[model samples]
Target: MPSSLSGRTVLVTGATSGIGYESARQLSERGATVLVHGRTPEEARAATDRLIAAAGADAARLRPVSADFARLEDVERLAEAVVRDHPRLHALVNNAAMAAPERHTLTEDGNEIAFQVNFLAHYLLTNLLEPALTSEPGGRVVNVSSSLHRAAAIQWNDPQRIRRYSRLAAYAQSQLALTVFAADPRVTAVSVDPGICATGLLPLYGHEGMPAAEGAAHVVHLCDPSTEIVNGAYYDRSTRVAPAAAATDDRTVKRLTKLADLLVGHTA
Candidate 1:
């Protein structure tokens, strides 16, 4: 795997900590030029340094990029910077996501924080970088989704959850939307459920699961060139599985994509 990605470049969002950090480290060790993205410049730099230390002789392959997912403008800027710096991105790992916000809050863009960060921002970024992704063969887009999506439904009438809000529901809905979006055929894409990792996210809910590194393995496997995983599929760790019924609905996917485009102000 290391030799396969020796000359390739990939971006891992939310690489500042948790599963994202572990995923970045693994990819860097595999000789991939990793763009480590965080919500802040300071954290991004720190994560990049950690990855460099872990990569040893491959230190130079890691780069840092920061963008607050809560801000759509920041997401747009992040994508533009990525295209300007890396003209041909071989893969994209949309691993950045947020959950368990104590209260329902709206971002500056007027979208719910979880909805924007967990799905819409990645949606916009992937679309913006479509050209770079398709410029090379075997380009991949891995969306870090969750099994919890199976228990949630898209709030079509209240997509933002303004009428009724629950942190769990918001997070699951965002993941479901992402799974639906990953079904698009424009690029080689897959949605992954990293299992219930004992990351910082779990503690907020009064529980813990597996280590972050263990959970990251699922993402690393998807990024592997040798994996026979099909595009537009959902996986629980390394096993392909059916996602929520809504996620498999063609009509739902289209509706979600249309709403996402409107939210991100993307014409297409």
Candidate 2:
């Protein structure tokens, strides 16, 4: 099979399972040096093995970076690794996500579980990896967002959702926040929905879904040279679409940067 990203280095978060896992596998098979990031070391190692086995000796290009998205320090560490090790990152598939389908819980950073893991963690990581991202032309950030974001409110006053909570509601908040952050001018950000993939992940949320590999197709498509759009935008199943008016607002973007800065130990 031909690799769309031949000669590139791609990093995918939450790459040990489901959609993220599949993306990394496909990328590695095609010739990109794939970095497989998962929340745990042992699991990340297994994921690396899977990719290597799938891609054969050529898959030796895969690297596993274990990180816990529940903490900011871990995210900072991921940034450092990407910056120090990879001179040029052709693509960043910011695909790690958590549903947080239970009652309220806080991460080590004191942020809500869904907010911290799904959006904020990737937010901080992306900021830290900018030097590598812009090192060459056609560098892209494919942020995996959701159609569920259509119903989310950008709780600016209390993003942690500490005062109130609903599993799906908070989950949607994180997705919407991702959409907004992707609109920033610093990089080419494209948020996309892979549809509902049938995977071990859905049982965690009590939902039935579609095939995981099929769900991963949009991400695979977005990373290709023939994708219809070329700048910061949104896509769902290969079609270009607007995320939301609020998702692209400057004030909200500024607000998101402020929150992310606080988490990353920087001044917004």
Candidate 3:
């Protein structure tokens, strides 16, 4: 691991607010070029401006990137743009996500809204950006997963939850899938449950949570080259622990990868 992030480039998705935003700020403060991703171009630019103004981040080190995760095409375009512009991306923080709506909803891409936005889109985006990802020792992917994943199971045949729907279940399933994705051999990656930070998704945790910056700290810690990590590891804040059994199963990783590829209309 490098002693400093100087010259390293990192992309943080869903960076417009909360932990994602804080993570971007912290990364920029550490001297990495931070690609701040948001759902829209306006939001992306505004986030960069906020980082500059509020966090004292170098404006030159922050670049705005946008794509709506609800739309696979948007994720594809976002991936293409990043790969073209930053071919040596040192790390990718899969931090963008959404709470499942109270009512069951499907994205235009025909998958459960939360599943598409939280998991599948990231699945597609990470794979698409493979060409851009750095192969250096410290280069890796950090999945901002959730503790709730332990209680969820992927509905293999009905991932869309069309027949029975519970917002909590839908969201948990997505998180579980993301955790499982960390085990993929194609990328060096790890997943972390940021300890229930107070954010838009706090309601799902059923209690008061810590500040978003604290959670972002856990995420930024993993992004630091000084931190030693193994692929497929799961962490609860700064401590590493076991993830759900399914998340570590090789068969499960392969299955989820296939399912995600199919869901996002990607081959392999």
* Candidate 2 deviation (Cα RMSD): 2.0
Instruction: Candidate 1: count the clashes.
Output: 0
21-63 per-residue lDDT for model 1 (tens digits): 9999888877889999999989999888877665462668888
Give the residue spans of candidate 1 off by over 4 A: 1-3, 54-57, 204-206
Q: Please give the lDDT score at residue 161 for candidate 2.
A: 81
Cand. 2 TM to true fold: 0.93
TM-score of 3: 0.97
Where does the lowest 10-residue lDDT sum fall in candidate 3?
130-139
TM-scores for every predicted model: 0.95, 0.93, 0.97
lDDT of 2 by residue, 140-235 (tens): 889998888888897878888888888888988988988888887788878888877876557544578877677777887777655554555878
Model 2 gets an lDDT of 0.81
Q: Which candidate number maximizes TM-score?
A: 3
Q: Which candidate is the best by lDDT?
A: 3
